[model samples]
Target: MLAKRIIPCLDIKNNEVVKGINFEDLKSAGDPVALAKKYDDELADELMFLDITASSEKRKTILKLVEKISENIFIPFSVGGGVSEIEDIHNLLNSGADKVSINTAAVINPEIIDEAAKKFGSSTIVIAIDAKKVGDEYLVFTYGGKKNSGINAIQWAKEVYNRGAGEILLTSMDKDGTKSGYEINLTSMVVRSVKIPVIASGGARDAKDIEEVFVKADAGAALAASIFHYENSGIISIKKYLKSKGINVRL
Candidate 1:
């Protein structure tokens, strides 16, 4: 059986690694380049670097940071933000990114998905969906969760899959920083809504939360930020916990 991956996510703002709750009230963590190297040395399955402000600010991805982060990490790396065209994807890949994720630009124009997939293959095109539960139904949000697209989360997942996206990085805005648990209902819906891999993000408080996302929630993989960021949680401990629960994971 294939071992499930444990990935560490980095939210980069102003060229520094940072984190926030529900995509608001940002705070610095450390130098992104230095942090990337640490995760690499720690033997993380993979690393994700997201320029949190790039989409909202309408700026290009930081190629310098891309090069710096990839320099030390042999594991696969994915980068996103302000990616709107094939050229943008091309530049990032050229800069050493193994994969590219698109969000807001994808919301504005989904055709970019097909174009990118055709150019880079489905394996390299990942779609990051930020969903917030509104009342009873989960709705999709864009621009760092600042704007709602009036579209349901499941529907958007299906649409992006049809557009040739390779994977879904589904994040629950409500559970983002709380670390209580994952949005199991929303995650199950997304995993069922699409045929591709679904990576669950947000609401990972402890090892139990990680186990639930993989077992009950049925996610392809589970990702966390602040818990791992603050050293309150370690990937090795989480991996061990997952293994003890009979889940396949790298030890």
Candidate 2:
């Protein structure tokens, strides 16, 4: 079996890393390049850089900044936010992104997933789904979690997989930045509904939270921001903890 991955997310805004609770009232976390190097040195499985406001602000991702951060990290890097066209994905990959994640564009035109995957190969495409619980149903949200797409989250997951997306970056808006834990039920539901690997995001406070998601929801990866950004924990230490718990993680 492939070892589970621990990915540290860098939410970028104004070319700087930032973090916010429930995607509101954001604050600076640090420099994206510096943090990328730090996580690389600490043996993080992968790094995800998201231009948190790019879609909402109606701009493309900062390619110059993405290239700069990409230079500092040796591990596989994923870039997302404000990605709308095939050209955008191509440019991000040229800027050194190993994978390009699309959320808003995929929802606005579902055909983009089929087109992108066909052109770029499935492993190069990642579908990011930002979901919120509404009236006993998990609905997809877009534009940096500011608008509800009114699409069922589980159904969307299966659609993306069928459309050839290689993986799903599933984030629960209700649990985002709360640091309480992952939304296990939601994660498990999506995991069961799709064949592609699911990377659980949003509400990871510590190793135990990550372990819970991996064990209970069968997530392929756990992505967190606050815990790693604030130095509350280190990637190596967390991998050590997971290893002690018999969770296979690259050290």
Candidate 3:
């Protein structure tokens, strides 16, 4: 079995790392480059840098910022936000991102997924889906979780995989920053609906929460921010805890 990965997510706004509950009321956490290096040193399985406002603000991801963080971290790094075109993906990859995640653009023109995968290889493309549960249906949101795409989340997951996306970064907006746990029901549904790897994001509080997602939902990875950003836990400690629980992880 492949070892489950633990990724530290850094949401960037104005070049600073920020955190918020349910994607609102954002507050600065720290410097992005510094945090990236810290996570790398702590042996985090991977690092995700998201320019939280780039898409909503109508600008490209800060390549300079991506370049700086990439310089500090040796681990695989994934970047997202304001990525709308092949050129954006090319620029981000050249700037040191191991993978480029597209959300709003993918919904606007899913053909880009097929085109990008063909041009850059499936491994280089990641489709980020921000979903919110409305009644019994999970709807996809875009533009940094500001707009509802009205697309069914589960179906979209399968569509992206069929279009040749390498992976899916699934974020539950309702669970985001709550730190209660990942939305397991929602995650499990997406996981079972697609064959490609799915990185579960939002509402991760501790190692047990991660373990639950990996065990119950069968998530490929669990991404968190609060625990790591606030010193509530460290990557090494979390990995050790998961290993103790008999979960396969890279320590």
Candidate 4:
């Protein structure tokens, strides 16, 4: 079996790494370049740099920041926020992003997914779904989880996969930054509903949380922010813990 990846998410705001609960109450984490280097040295499976406020600010991602980060880390880096057109994707990739994650843009113009996949290969396109639980099902949210898109999370996962996205970055808004645990039900739902790999995000407090998601939710990867960003658990330590728990992980 392929090893389950442990990814650290850097929520970049104003060119610095930040963390928050339920997507609010933000706190500064540290410099993005330093954090990226730390994770790289510790052997993180992958890294994600999300310009969390770009969409809300109505501007493009920080290309200079992306370039700086790319120069510091060798791991696969995925970038998102304010990515609407194919040109944006090209620019980000050229700026050193290995994959371009699209959330609001994908919801607004899904054809962009297919177009990007065709131009850059499906492996380079990841669709990020920020979801909040509502009634019996989860609803997709946009604009950094500030607005409900009314699109069913499960359906949207399948839609994006069918549209040629190679992966799904599923973030549970309710579980985000709470560190209670992953929303296993939601993660599993999306995992089983789609053929593409699903990277589970939000509510990761420690190694056990990562283990649970991989074991129960069968997530392809577990993405965390506060824990890794604040040094609650380093990537190597988390991987060792998962390996001890019988999970397939690189150590």
lDDT of 4 by residue, 56-170 (tens): 4434437888888898788899998778889889989999999999999899999999999999999999999999999989999998898899999999999999989999999
Q: Deviation in angstroms for 4 in model 4? A: 0.6
lDDT of 3 at 12: 83
**Local distance difference test, candidate 3:** 0.86
TM-score of decoy 3: 0.91
| Model 1: per-residue Cα lDDT over 1-251, one tens digit each | 88887788988876877663222212423677667766666657888888766444334447777887778778898998777788989989988899999998998898999999998999999999999999888999998899999888899999999989999999999998887899998999999889998989998888889899889878998887767654446777778778888999877
What are the clash counts of all predictions, listed in order? Answer: 0, 0, 0, 0
Candidate 2 on 31-149: residue-level lDDT in tens? 67767777788888999988866444434447787778777777899998788899989988888899999999999999999999999999999999999999999999998899989
Ten-residue region with minimum lDDT total, candidate 3:
20-29
TM-score of each: 0.90, 0.91, 0.91, 0.91
Where is model 4 poorest over a 10-residue stretch in terms of lDDT?
20-29
For residue 223, model 2's alpha carbon misses the true position, in angstroms, by 0.4
- lDDT (CA) per prediction: 0.83, 0.87, 0.86, 0.86
Could you tell which candidate, 1 or 4, scores higher by TM-score? 4
Give Cα distance to truth, residue 101, candidate 3, Å.
0.5
Error of 4 at 205 (Å): 1.1
Cα-lDDT of candidate 2: 0.87
Root-mean-square deviation of every model: 4.0, 3.9, 3.9, 3.8
